[model samples]
Target: QQQVKQSPQSLIVQKGGISIINCAYENTAFDYFPWYQQFPGKGPALLIAIRPDVSEKKEGRFTISFNKSAKQFSLHIMDSQPGDSATYFCAASMSSGYSTLTFGKGTMLLVSP
Candidate 1:
């Protein structure tokens, strides 16, 4: 079973500010951490991800950091903008074999213009 906890159900960030979201899991079997970004009426898209073997991964303005010892990870959005407002979900899954993803409740991010 996957027990993942995500914090700060919602967040407000000003344009050009940085947005941070955190997540912690209790399952060591999880090997992959993927952050999904969802818009009002669209499916969630993979924003960034990090594997257990790596400490962090950065893509454009997004970043994901992993802490294997703590079983925690976080997503950071640099230079936040009004268009970046969306719901972010932190998920965990096994990279190998067949496994379903365990997702946190999700964090609603709002960036003001």
Candidate 2:
């Protein structure tokens, strides 16, 4: 119930296209769902997030579509860009004190020019 599973360890999307990645978890106790985007040798930054209470969340060109009953969520990058190429991670964590996140193996996105 603590694992977040992601697919397509790597992906190549042309610039101006859309990049999609999927993830699922088993833990119903988890309250926060966040996606982090990381560049080489850099720490992951929170891109966008959605609580279980919400069905979806969007930030600029990034969007998160969540499915509560299916225990799944996905990240959609609209208008993929070379600069958007990075390692994306899906994570889950409980709201309680000191809850560390469980991250997916990671999906490397490559946006070609």
Candidate 3:
């Protein structure tokens, strides 16, 4: 079964705008949620992540907002740029000593100038 669900199969944003992506999970066992960014012909790279212990986490222009009770999370990109155009994925996994990620369907973001 798909553990995570992501919305807005595609998004378009202008330069300097903000882009948002959202995801939700039904499994309470998921303790780690991470968002990944992937460009063409490349593997997904970890962008931002959050543990249920924290409500939010931020790194530079990337931010992750987590809601444990609701089993939801979202990613925000500040100052969206053309270079930021890529496919984004939200993933969930248990920190059960093994590193395995179940990813949601990707969202393709286009940041145009």
Candidate 4:
């Protein structure tokens, strides 16, 4: 119950379009949900996050929609741009103490001009 599986290992979208990626988890003990964005060899950075107490969270161009009962979450990029091209990872962690994050396989987003 520690796995978070993501899909569409890669994605291609045009500028100004929407980019979507989905992920699911098995651990009910996980209470913190976060989406991270990585460029090249750099470590993933927290782009946005949600808790089991919330259904959704948004920041700038990034949005995370969460379903508590289904144990699923998704990232939605609005008005995606070529600069948005990067690897996106969905992760889960516990709210208490120092818990290692469980990351999804990752989704490579390619926004072509």
Candidate 5:
């Protein structure tokens, strides 16, 4: 079974609008939650991350909201720009594991100009 589940396979937003993507994971052992942004023909890069210790995190226009008890998390992009159009992925990982990331099916965000 997929460890993580993501919704809204695709999304479109107007310029300066907020884009939201959500995810839920099955494994309670997961200690870290991270969001990645990937552009076509390029690799996914880390966008934002949150630990179970915190409820939320933000960097620039990207924000990650995490819920420990619910085993769920979401990404919110504020004031999204056209350049922000890309695939976003939510992932879970544990330091004790193989050190590999378990990613949710990605969300494709299209930010219109």
Candidate 6:
């Protein structure tokens, strides 16, 4: 079984600031790194992802980075708002197999005005 380790159990960011969460994996076979966002009452949804071949991927205010050599990845939320506050999770899985994601402990982010 593979594992993903995440840092900073919780975080607080001011509005328009940047919030970053990091994760490290020990499985070299994992090829996909994704970040999931979960709001107060909703289930987690994919926010952004990066492949081992790419160094980074960005969408809107979200960015995901992949470091194949280090077997690590990260998520960066830019211009963060209170609405963006959520429980973020870092996950890894093999693209070819069933999407059984190995998730991290999750990071609770609070964006304050």
Model 1: worst 10 consecutive residues (lDDT sum): 1-10
Model 4 stretches astray by more than 4 angstroms:
none
Give the better candidate number (3 or 4) by TM-score: 3
lDDT of 3 by residue, 8-64 (tens): 899999999999999999889889999999999999998888899999999999999
Over 4 Å off in model 2, which ranges?
none
Q: Candidate 3 clashing pairs?
A: none
Q: After superposition, how far is residue 22 of candidate 1 from its true place, in Å?
A: 0.2
lDDT (CA) per prediction: 0.93, 0.94, 0.94, 0.93, 0.92, 0.90
**Local accuracy of candidate 4 as per-residue lDDT tens digits, 13-108:** 999999999999999999998889999989888899899898888899898999989999999999999999999999999989998799999999
> Positional deviation of 21 in candidate 3, in angstroms?
0.2
Candidate 3 residue runs with Cα over 4 Å from true position: none
Model 4 residue 84 distance off true place after TM-score fit, in angstroms:
0.6
- C-alpha-based local distance difference test score of model 2: 0.94
lDDT of 2 by residue, 1-113 (tens): 43899988999999999999999999889889999999999999989988988888999999999999999999999999999999999999998899889999999999999
Estimated TM-score for each candidate: 0.96, 0.96, 0.97, 0.95, 0.96, 0.95
Model 5: which residue pairs collide? none
Candidate 1 TM-score to native: 0.96
TM-score winner among the candidates? 3
* Clashing pairs in model 4, backbone N/Cα/C closer than 3 A: none
How does model 2 score by TM-score?
Answer: 0.96
